[model samples]
Target: MTHLSGGPALPQERRLVTAVPGPKSLELLARKNAAVAAGVGVTLPVFVTRAGGGVLEDVDGNSLIDFGSGIAVASVGNSAEAVVRRATEQLEAFTHTCFMVTPYEGYVEVAERLAELTPGDHPKKSALFNSGAEAVENAVKIARAHTRRTAVVVFDHGYHGRTNLTMALTAKNMPYKQGFGPFAPEVYRVPLAYPFRWKGDAQACAAEAAEAAIDQITKQIGAENVAAVIIEPIAGEGGFIEPAKGFLPRIAEFAKANGIVFVADEIQTGFCRTGQWFACEDEGIVPDLITTAKGIAGGLPLAAVTGRAEIMDAAHSGGLGGTYGGNPVACAAALGSIETMKELDLPARARRIEEIMKPRLAALMDKYDVIGEVRGRGAMIAVELVASGTRDGAKEPDAATAAAVAKACHAAGLVVLTCGTYGNVLRFLPPLVIGEDLLNEGLDIIESAFAGR
Candidate 1:
């Protein structure tokens, strides 16, 4: 009844002594509202005191089952022994010699490991960064440098980042994109092979989407002008929509044939979150460049743009580095995170998570008319909620119901997250080290929330 994946488990169960956002948390919230910026948002305002091994304890002494994994940044658990040890060692020695100014081994080692673990054996190289958006922007820069083209292509319902260029790349409107206009130019949005929303079967959907995308690139953007075709191997933040089978391969082939760089924005799906070292491996689709962050360094801020040596080196001598890019501490944590992943075979653990969650979610679909579909891969699972009306047509998105379910779970002692362009998808991104008891308890809370709603 114990898990040793993370350092010293903290009684992996839900315990609610006070209300969800007890007195201490409310006190912090009031201070935060006065001190913090209005644009910043929080999913659950419970001030966390400590966390590890599938449980997060708030100041109010409420231990909630962590189903979000800090938005999938804690794949190896929050305080994996290896991560803590390595990071602590690095912190003690030196925290900030910034690799750009004073080069260090940890950053070089991280790049080396990225080359070894990422998809493809094409003499890959990497440049580390401080965040996912920075990695993504650098990827586009590298692609543009290599291809000497100005146009970048992205897909619908995709969430890239919050930077100016990334905001242009993203497809959402309200929170991420709205009021942030005049985005980077020459960025074209294409159709994604969303199986559930497609008009036909899976294969047909893939064919249609691929054809449409190719047509758009050919006529509108012109392949000759396109520097890169970037996409999420398994789209994240866009409802965990797995690209229909055959969709990614066709896009890769088209990019290759047209001398365009194919970039996989695996910030959310990389680092064994999707049952593979990278989600691109699921269909044998090797991207020309891959952007990664999130789970790269346990819970630290680290990211990388890894790709073929030629493409990565295309950037000028000093073109691709930030002052804080690849800090020694973050790099050390990343090395430890990768070591822990390999030692524990976290990819297999993610597969086991899929095995446990998919069936339960599928069963819910049969019982709940609001659950239009359950989709995703490995531990990155989600259920799309819809307003039920007819059986043969499109289901109306029920954002209100999704909000209620998430709020209800929060009221109880479970941490869950909702996503999707329509905001009707409940995504479950549990830490790979979560125990069965806690996992089941989180599911029970979700089921009860739906029932009560």
Candidate 2:
């Protein structure tokens, strides 16, 4: 019952003292437009001055319910209690000597924790990094070294990261990989068993998609040339698409049989976001390599590639690591975050979030014609909008409706976010520590948005 999040002390209730992007925020937005990079985007155009528990207090004095949790990075909540305490202590003690240069116990402790926490009981090893993209890129490097192969397989609608190699692995184009072309070679794309969009016979989609993906690899690239099969157990930016049952297992089995490393890119779905320490555990899928980042350090920049010791150690001594990799402060924060997760049993809390959110979103689907489907697990739920919501499952995406609804939610002091390759999925990644009342209020705002209230 001890589910606490530490941040600026503020009321948890929603209070719109002014418009979401009120005078102060508007002033800041004006400055940002002039000073910041054009490519950088703003979701609500509000400047957060404080955040904690379930609410974000903007500079405009509006308390917005935080449904996005800074894209799931603050699952333990912004400035989580332990995170602040440990990071403060570490910061005051010593910032960095770089594990590769001077080494530190904090780094080793974080690595050991990763080995203990990540899926599988096998002897595991981990290499820490600064971002999810870095973790993913290194995972590929390790896979290639271990398998001594070049081809890497990823699925359609799978978003790995924004870096060159990762961008190549990512399937979306517009915002992620449009002009950044001439991407890394040797990465192959395959079909995902996305249930909602699967052509026919939903129950058989998993077997069919697995076979299709396997056939493509066997014929297109040849299994011997493949280094790894990387995937998100639940697709993130490309919509929170949870692949059909049996598909993941089949792919993992195929990779194991062919000596292809199976990597679960659990960047967005890890650390209790999906009711488990890692989403792969939902299906009992133990990857050869798993990349984690977003929630690892409770909002700090920390990422890791953890896997079987043999695969993780395949690279030479100096092959892996960065100047900022496993910095003492981030390591300390990660330890604190992990401690908080276990102490609070955030995985169970995430399940509680699912229990509270999914039904409400499903109810919204029932009430709105624009809602195509309500999908996702634990705190990572989403509502896929279509031209017409139907139990039969309409496929036409209604991006306009999604955008309008999200805009309305923001105006009403609810911090909502949208995703999907088609840009028609409204995603919700509430901090696990969010109170039930705030959760309900956020849901009420969603209902109002759809009702045009």
Residue 45, candidate 1: Cα error in Å is 0.9
Measured against the true structure, the TM-scores of the candidates, in listed sequence, are: 0.99, 0.98
- How well is each residue in 124-192 modelled by candidate 1, as lDDT tens digits? 999999889999999999999999999999999998999999999998887998887888998999999
Q: What digit string (tens of lDDT, one per residue) describes model 2 on residues 298-322?
A: 8889999999999999999999999
Model number with the top TM-score: 1
Error of 2 at 420 (Å): 0.5
User: What Cα-based lDDT does every candidate model obtain?
Assistant: 0.91, 0.92
Tell me the number of clashing residue pairs for each predicted model. 0, 1
What stretches of model 2 exceed 4 Å from their correct place?
A: 1-3, 389-394
All predictions: root-mean-square deviation over Cα? Answer: 1.0, 1.4
